[model samples]
Target: MMTVTDLDCLRGQRRVLSGVSFALDAGDCLILRGPNGAGKTTLLRTLAGLSPAPRGALSTAPEDLVYTGHLDAVKPQLTVAENLTFWQGIYQNAPQDTLNSFDLDELADRPAATLSAGQKRRLGLARLHVSGRKIWLLDEPTTALDADHVARFTDTLQAHCNGGGIAIISTHLDIALPQARTLNVADFAARQDRTADEEADPFLQGAY
Candidate 1:
């Protein structure tokens, strides 16, 4: 189980998050929603361990977290399969044909930079298949994805949750995540704004 105590974040002069608290047990999904600069990305980065914890709340085991952002985190030069291999080396060994399961078999040899946005996202999603980590942090996960890929992502996420994995996704899309709780960060932090240097909230500006 992963527990996030209170997360206090300051972006520049603004306090993006103050005493923000939430808990996610095993197999739970938390959907993060907010406006353009509601600190949604900042929170995701903190969860990813890519950004520093400012104050109050948020304690976690770094090894247990998995993060995927809008950038896809792919090596433009590496082929589809190579990227998976690299990730497998970092995470745990993946199940057989994990790429195939995501309908990426045909493009396994294609360079990640050459694929469309949706395909790249799938490759990023495939990492969860073998990551073995229980916590997931995804940002803008559904951007540029077609219906089929979205369905696949939802299915895999549901399976992961069923198997005791928890996920926190930041997206504008409204997919049917029955058990998922959608929280709007904008509602909580829209009253304030700040710069990264001021509060050192790097994730607020795609630090990771």
Candidate 2:
């Protein structure tokens, strides 16, 4: 289980989130919906332990965490399999056959830089299957994916949740996600006494 207690976030001198709190149990898949600057990524970063501590408490299995952001975070020069192998050494220890689940076996020997944008998105997503983590934090996961890859991603997400894994995704495109918890940034801002676009920053790149 993942517990987030009264989390607060600061970007520069601005308070991005104040008294932000939530809990994620196994089987929980939360989707964050906000305008351009709603602080979704800030929240994700905080949850991933990459940001400054918030005002509240967070008690979770730190090691059981997997975070993938807008950036691919993969070595551009490395082969697909080599990249996976490197991440496996640091992030997971899944069976070798798990690569087949993502239909990446054929591309294993290919250089990561040579993959198409959609292919890279698929490659990024393939990490979730191999990762033995309990919690997944994804930001705009469908960034460069096409219809087929998106469908595959949705199925993969369903399987992960079915297997007791929790995921938090922030995206612009809406697809049917089973049993998901949707938190609107508009509502969040209203409660926080801010304007509609005030809290939704992801849509606006300069905010980041």
State the C-alpha lDDT per candidate.
0.80, 0.78
Off by over 4 Å in 1: 190-208
| Model 1: lDDT of residue 88 | 89
Clashing pairs in 2: 36-200, 36-201, 36-202, 36-203, 37-199, 37-200, 37-201, 38-199, 38-200, 38-201
Give the per-residue Cα lDDT of candidate 1 at 170. 90
lDDT of 2 by residue, 24-101 (tens): 788999998888888888878878888886377888867888899988776779888888888788774755765666
Candidate 1 lDDT at 137 equals 89
For each candidate in turn, the TM-score is 0.85, 0.85
Worst 10 residues of 2 by lDDT: 185-194
Q: Backbone clashes per model, in order?
A: 7, 10
Among the numbered candidates, top lDDT falls to: 1
